[model samples]
Target: MSITARLLRYFAFFWILFLCAGTIYQYINFKHDTYFIHLKQTAVATGWYLPAFYCHIFGSSIILLAGFFQFSKTVYNNRPLHKALGKLYVFGVLFFAAPGAYVMTLFINRGGFVFASFFIQNTLWVIFTLSAFLLVKNGKIDAHVKMMHRSYALAFGAVMLRFYIWLFMRLGIGVDFENNYIIISFLSWVPNLILVELINRYNKCPYRTLQN
Candidate 1:
């Protein structure tokens, strides 16, 4: 890896760890009203929201950590371990994380656009992840790798959403919280997927030529 790629890898690793740690600490008490939950008391009252919230939080955390290592040369060389982690990541997203996110989207009241953004994001997340699993099952390794990259790009949106929120706040770009959230809702995942596409193009990923 080039120095820049190495640096980005380290940065991403530490950033994910930091976010996961914060999420764990925030919900360690399992309280009904806490952090973001505190803002969604109405949603919490629905009885379904809290369970879905926990599912998304805990499930996404596992997949986030596991998926990050999916790109590691060391882990990739260890076929058994890589396959194990891939299974964990796929099942975690399909069964727990993505489904939970889908449920949560129904409760979003941040206007139709914001809701649309999240709904679309969750939908694509499932599609990409499922495609990755199916492609690998069919022994299409290159396509599987491409799809996995797309899947994790959306997965990383959880991190990017929070990062952008913090960044916007610090930069004083969007003072209105509601409008700011609306912007970040799309910003979080769109750029991630676009960047992944650009990277695949630069690397001449086989999936691109296959599509062409």
Candidate 2:
């Protein structure tokens, strides 16, 4: 790895670990506290909050770490671990995270605009993930890798969403809660995709071709 690639790898590793820690904290809160806030809301509305929340929290957290390692050429060269993690990542997203996201999208506040944004994000997330899986199944390794990068970028929205929320609150750019959420809903994953594009364009890394 070049100096820049090494630095990027370290940054990605620690950033993902940080997100995993945050997610695990949420899991602990739900597991121990019964997620009383959500339970109360669910009592008022049949949202199935616990299942959906747990699915997204756990599934996404697990996938963040799994997917981070996936970018390492070392791991990708190790066929057994690479394939194992790839299957786990796909299964987690397909069965748990994406489904949970779609279900939870029904409960987003601030009305239709926010709902549409999240709905689109969740839908594309699933589509990209499925494409990645299908590409790999058909032996299109380069395409599969590109698609997986795209899918994982969207998945990282959980972290980027929180960051945007915090940053905007600090700056008082859009302090209105509903409006803030509205911005972050689309803001979260869009920058991630753009970043992925820029990295692919500039880095010109062999394994990082954008053949679609």
Candidate 3:
């Protein structure tokens, strides 16, 4: 593998480890946490928040685990297993994960443009994930792959959210982390989508854009 690819693989591995572990731990703790419970109780948005919250915790944990497998040379070549897991991944996002994310985004305590920006991104994540699924169903191979990659990038934003927050604190800009999150919200997936485009460009693959 090229040096860049090797470094990216290492980065992906560490991110999966860090975020997956944190998500699993936080979720298990959330099951008994009065803080989360109280937030659910006092918040008017529990209807979607609770489900989305758990979905994020559990679904993301599952995705982060499954993500490693998706890139595996063994599984990637095994179409049946790949398709099966991909279906599960997509289902988790469409019905459980992405929808829940949208709900939670609505209840973000940091009300303002940050909320608006996140909500917008959350909505796009849903659309992107669903569009990917439908493209696959319609037998649009290239589009399906591109859209799915975009969806996963948005899903991976959950990890980047934490990454930027930590970066902010390390830089002693803790108070401005909210602003940092807003920037990350847009940037996290945008670059991923752009990378997908670059990949397609390099491979000379034809894809159907959302405009199409």
Candidate 4:
């Protein structure tokens, strides 16, 4: 990779790691009250919420870091390692992250709009991830790569969700907390998927590998 490309890749990798680390830190003590301040009522009301929350948190963090390396030429060339990480990423999303997100969607206290946003996003994440796994199994490498890109885009929404929440708070956008959250619920994943689609289109040339 060119120096610029390498720098950008490392930047993104570390940025994702930083976000994941910060999120994991919040739950380091495994206390139900740590990040569940607002969801305490829901947690008490539903027996499944805490389990789903932990699954999504830890599972998504592992997949986010693993998925980043999926695009690396070095990793891609190492078939055993690539397949191992691919399985990790796929299973992480399908069995843990996506399922957990689906369960959590049921408990979203935000209005229907926010709930719908998360439901759809989570649905797409599962579909894209499953499709990628199936495609690779069938030896459809090119299509598999494309679908994996889409899957990872949705996965990155976790980080984007937090970043947007922080940004909105800093910029004083959508001053109402409920309204702000509603906006962020959609903002989190839509733009990431759109950007991924644009990148896929721009790099459609057969000679252009995803690693580039």
Candidate 5:
């Protein structure tokens, strides 16, 4: 790797580590604190909340950080490790995180718009993951890469949500909390997809846009 590429890679590595560390800390804090911090009273009323919450939090944190190492060329060349990580990622999302998100969506902060944004985000997250898995199974490496890139972008939404919240707080920009969250619901993932699109275009992957 060139110097600039190495620098960018290190930056991305640390950034992902930061997000993963924050996620772990938040989950650990939630475990000891007792009640739901972000959920509405209605969601808390549901007995399924904690189980689903843990599933998404723990599973997503693993999936998010797993991507950082999985993308390494060295790891990719190591068939066993690559395959193992891929299976773990698929299991975490399909069986735990994605289902948890689907259930949790029913209880998001009030307003149809907020719910819908999150609904789409989680739905796409699952779809992208499955698509990546299926593509790789069929030996479509390029298509799989395209799909996985999209999946990671959505997975990173959890991290982006917190960043935006902190950014707003640091700016001392006061807005209705509910409205702000609703905006963040969409903002976190949409820009990520747009960014991936720009990368796909410039990088000129073997299968640009994953078209056959």
Candidate 6:
């Protein structure tokens, strides 16, 4: 493989591993932590919270796990399974995951900026997914693919959040971690979309092409 390809492969592997491990750690810790349990219980006391939590957790997990697969060019070219998975992914994000994220955002403790960042992310996530679905429905495959890529890039914030924390902690900066999280809430995805924009530019792929 070329050096760039090799670097990308290594990055992808490490990213996927770190994401899986960190999320598992967080979930396990959440299960044992009295604070999280109490918060969950409180959320459950309200009728919408429990369902939102479940959808957010399960749907996000599934999206993260399945998202990497969608990036494979080979899989995109494969008609049957690809379309089926794409439909399922869109449904999961739109009907369950994104809505759940919006509902859960009301309870975020990172104060206004962080909550607003996530609220925006959730909104954009739904828009990206819906746009991708509409493109495919209209037989615009390239637009569908690019839009779905943007959608998955937003979903990758969960992975990037932990990655940034690890970076700051390892750097031994004395800054307050909570403040760092506030920054990361937005930083995690803004650069992602920028990277996507660069890719589209380099590839000369218009966001939505019309070939009349």
Clashing pairs in 5: none
Candidate 6 or 1, higher TM-score? 1
Q: Which ten residues in a row have the lowest lDDT in candidate 3?
A: 203-212
Error of 3 at 106 (Å): 1.6
lDDT of each: 0.87, 0.79, 0.70, 0.83, 0.79, 0.75
Q: Write candidate 2's Cα lDDT for 1-212 as tens digits.
A: 78997896786677678878977875665553545354448432674866786788899889888888888778977778988999999999999998988777777656898889888888888999999999988877667777887899999887777767778878877646656677778898888899887765665546643222
Model 2 residue 190 lDDT score: 86
Clashing pairs in 4: none
lDDT of 5 by residue, 137-166 (tens): 787887788888899889888877767777
- Indicate which candidate wins on TM-score: 1
By lDDT, the best candidate is 1
In model 4, which range of ten residues has the least summed lDDT? Answer: 203-212
TM per candidate comes to: 0.92, 0.84, 0.82, 0.89, 0.85, 0.82
Model 4 error, position 144 (Å): 0.4
lDDT of 1 by residue, 122-185 (tens): 9999999999999988877788888899999999999988888788978988636657788899
Off by over 4 Å in 3: 34-41, 44-48, 175-178, 204-212
Give the clash count for model 3.
1
Ranking by TM-score, best first? 1, 4, 5, 2, 3, 6
**Could you give the C-alpha RMSD of every candidate to the true structure, in order shown?**
3.4, 3.5, 4.3, 3.1, 3.6, 3.8
- Write out the backbone clash pairs for model 2: none
lDDT of 1 at 87: 95
